[model samples]
Target: MIDVVAAILKQGDKILIARRKEGKSLGGYWEFPGGKIEEGESPEKSLIRELKEEMMIDIKVTEPFGENIHDYGDKKIRLIAFWGEIDSGEIVLKDHDCIEWVFPKDLHQYNFSPADVSFVEQLMK
Candidate 1:
């Protein structure tokens, strides 16, 4: 299984989510900002790197939102989620088609990937 880290980046009462670009896996779906964990890197390091690479933002990955393993038919992934806030830099999207700051209660409106949908439920609690 692939290990991935996602950031539940909070700014006030809102959290950041990105729309996957067309042609990518789970394309057109909204999900938390993060990517696969590379070899020899911790989840925090991977998330910090991914945010910089994908969103051009620096973040201090704080507390865990929790973890889940999901089967996506062809592949299964162990998703490690952390909720944090932006530490520095403005967001400049390099990968996703769009980005939005959504309140946890309203997250259900967006079409999120299955794994991130679970994260949303946790946030609402």
Candidate 2:
């Protein structure tokens, strides 16, 4: 399975979510901002690297939310979500189409990746 890490970054009552760019896998779907866990890197360490590379922001992981595994026919991944806060840097979108900071209660408004559905449900509970 493809191993990935996602960040559950919160600012006030809203959390950060990013949209996948067109032409990419799961393109046009929303997901927590993060990327794959590289070799020799822990999940949290991978998250810190991904957030910076993708969003140009620094984060300190506060807690691990949980994990989910899902398959989209051609591709499958195990995503680990974590709770974190911005440590530094400006918000820049190096990847993804755009971003939204939304209250979790309203997460239904956007189309999220299938792998993230469980994480969203757990957040609601």
Q: Each prediction's TM-score against the native?
A: 0.96, 0.95
Model 1: clashing residue pairs? none
Which segments of candidate 1 are over 4 A away from where they belong?
A: none
Clash totals, every prediction? 0, 0
User: Candidate 2 regions off by >4 Å?
Assistant: none
- What's the lDDT for candidate 2? 0.91
lDDT of 2 by residue, 3-63 (tens): 9999999999999999999888789999998999999999999999999999889999999
Per-residue lDDT tens digits of candidate 1, residues 31-125?
99899999999999999999999998899988888999999989999999998999999889778999999888988889999988888888877
Window of ten residues with lowest summed lDDT in model 2: 116-125
lDDT of each: 0.92, 0.91
Cα RMSDs, all models: 0.8, 1.0
lDDT of 2 at 25: 78
Query: Pairs clashing in candidate 2?
Result: none
**What is the model-wide C-alpha lDDT for candidate 1?**
0.92
